[model samples]
Target: MLRQVQKQMSLHSILYNKISENHILKKINYVVDFSFINKLLEDSYCKNFGRPAKEPEMMCKLLFLQHLYILSDEKVIEEANLNLGYMYFLGINPEDELPDKSLLSKFRTQRLEEATLDEIITEIVRQCVEKGIIGGTSVSVDATHIEANTIRKTPERLMKHLARKIIKTYEKENNQVLEEIPEVPKYKEIEDHTEAKAVMKDYLENVISKVKKNIRKDCSESIKTKETIEKAREIIEDPKFLNQKGVRSIIDEDARVGRKSKNQEFYGYKTEFMMTADERIITSVRTADGAYVDGTYADELIEQTLKSGMKIEEVYGDKAYFRKPILNSIEEIKAKAYIPVSESVYRIDESEFSYNKDSDEWECREGNITVKKKYYKIKGKSRPDREGYKYYFEPEQCKRCPKHDECAKKSARKILQIGLNTIEFYEISQYQKTEEYLEKYKKRASIEGKNAELKRFHGLYRARGYGLLSVSMQSKLAAIAVNIKRIAAIAASKFCIFTLNIKIFSQYYKFCLN
Candidate 1:
């Protein structure tokens, strides 16, 4: 009976109205990337009421597709509406009332405020879970510098820089000749600073040839350059005290000059994020002032993601997040923080915590005493400034110790900042020996790939908005778009799998007849 019912099933049966090929073609033809647009509309809410309440679902889809394709409002209305593929994917028609860019912008703003920018990201994440797009494995936590639209150098900043150079230039040359004073840009900010070092050099050269002897001594030309750039950097940092006369950067408070992991330096804001390995799903992200340190933000972010209900298993970060204090934090969360050992903690001696040939406990570096195992509550004791805690061999015991110089301090006790069960310490420690930790730990690098996708694939390198808020908003949107793409990819994969299963079943039926 069951087999007969299965055989009677009609493949052509429709779940809803039979969407005509003409209707599909018209909707999709005028559109941009059909698949991405389709993904943007995958959510039921987006499919149902994405457009105005009075507007048809098809029209709403076209507007959203326009947003996904990044077509200007005018372009989306005139060009996209005419294409069949775009129309079909949008579930809209050429005859339907098309939305202008303003309309699109308004809806985005509304949704952004209502659902919030992270809603799309949340949706994408949900899809990833449902489709088995990600493994609850290790994720990489890192940050990238996003260039701000502010000026690094200002005319006022330049004049302050140049005045010192002028004095130094005159002193170094011995006042050999006279030359015209150069105009200084006192307010040039950041990348917009017009005067390069070469121009600065030229100005000094002129001043040197003119008043070489009149200038004072005790400072070299290099000293002058150093002073000028230093003062300029200071001025750039504090915008409230602009001394020069020129336009200021639109953003100053949150923008900072920071270095990336690759050693490339830029003056901008920072974007910290976490990404899973399987599909590179960004689990969490933060936009911070450029002065923000990746190391400083890790612990807080760990807490936040946990609060968000993301079932974290382990976290991976570069040397930056190898905070020793975070180890206990990992334990508290029932998760792990996988940060690498920092070079700053190199002076530590682990011999005491080394493999005690018999007990298998890690010994301290000082091979002095037979045993010195003591655990103290972390709250009352001051945590040393190192990545791990500073524990030591008994100082009195170290006074006459043989490995004193190598392991113990003469006046100080042998202390090591033992990392709290953080995943970073786990890498070199005995933790990775476990299959579960190793499996999750290997996936941390995936976040770096996610960063690359955001910048290279999504065009999020330089934020388009003026203030940090705008930049943050744009960054979140890019994340949302990436999430949308992931959802679409999952949906497409499911569709493909469904088609394959049907094909296999048909083949089985043919064989049975034979």
Candidate 2:
């Protein structure tokens, strides 16, 4: 049930008004009209007839405050009870009782539907657009990683964890400990991971089968036992079960190992977002497993940004977003892509080698030209034939060259592979040399700052709870928090300008009268 609370001015309303107009809480309340939230969440609550529920708006406001200040559930409620600023932000009178902290956890994980979180972000962006704060057409996109809540475990340990969880649940629910349990394997004595995994798998299967057989014939009596057995069976049967990446932990199944760089890896999730350059306000966000490619979400981000009422005239990102499909998606929307070519795809040391566009060959500083070329078509069902080309230099020239050791040590000749879209990338590379591209590309840095702000201030540096759903909500709420902050600053600046104009007009009128 969604209880509608009528807010009449309390005696403390005067004190709330006394909270400086520039106060972050006051500014946020003034700029962000959360009335739309009630309508958006109406379906999630009973229309009537249930115990009077806390207003969805207030519940959501509690969450917003939680993320905005990076407070734990218990801490936020404590602050709201004691702090007048928090009370003003939540729109509750000082005398009004705040809901218990447990209700917040329930509201976040249960009452608030996963899909509604995205709508919440879109609504905020829409408000920004409607308020004329986000009128820019250029948006920057980027992805930041969030560390998983659980520590990573090896495949062997992960299997053991699963087996133990099932057995524990069975024993507790059935109130009978099975004495004839499967014997543990000496996995540490095994040298090969494959052999050890096979033995461990065999052991786990035995344990599961034994538990199922011992369960009372009335298996329907314990749904938890049945569910645990089913979940364990699914994990054991997965194709990637033996691989370390399959299920790192039973607690967080959605998190996966992802590369931050070639040599760096982190187990967690990714939050990809697009924000307007001029306004620095996030327009759209997507959450995915840590291993998800940054470029994969580019199309969705652009689409969502468009849906949020921001016209994207240009899109900016890092080299990871230089894929053909991503660029094509941007082009389809008639937005120019400012993503630089991936270094792995097209990189040449300007001082060492230069490309001759006329001959379609590379020239080394030693004045040697490439003599042979081979086109290696990408063999993939989803990709086009134009993958790239490999250019080979003459072995004889390299053998006789003075810089052979420096340029091609232990090799017969010099070779370079260039992407098939060399022309398009070349044009972008050339444009990268211009003042216009430099100025426009600078907008991409704002997203990095936003990412830092999220991690440093909004508790996005790590997952506060288990599973992707929780992290997704955390990321979106952080985005909303920052957007509200940006909007308030903009509104405050506009107000300052308006006041200055009025003062200037008043001075001019007085001078004329004199």
lDDT of 2 at 392: 89
lDDT of 1 at 322: 59
- Candidate 1 per-residue lDDT, tens place, 410-478, comes to 434555445444223434555545787567666676777778777876656876656566667667666
Model 2 clash pairs are: none
How far residue 361's Cα lies from its native spot in candidate 2, in Å, is: 8.4
lDDT of 2: 0.83
Cα lDDT for residue 473, model 2?
A: 85
Give the worst 10-residue stretch by lDDT in candidate 1. 1-10
Task: Give a tens-digit lDDT track for model 2, residues 51-72.
Answer: 9888888888888888888899
- Give the true-structure RMSD of model 2: 3.9
Model 2 TM-score (2 dp): 0.86
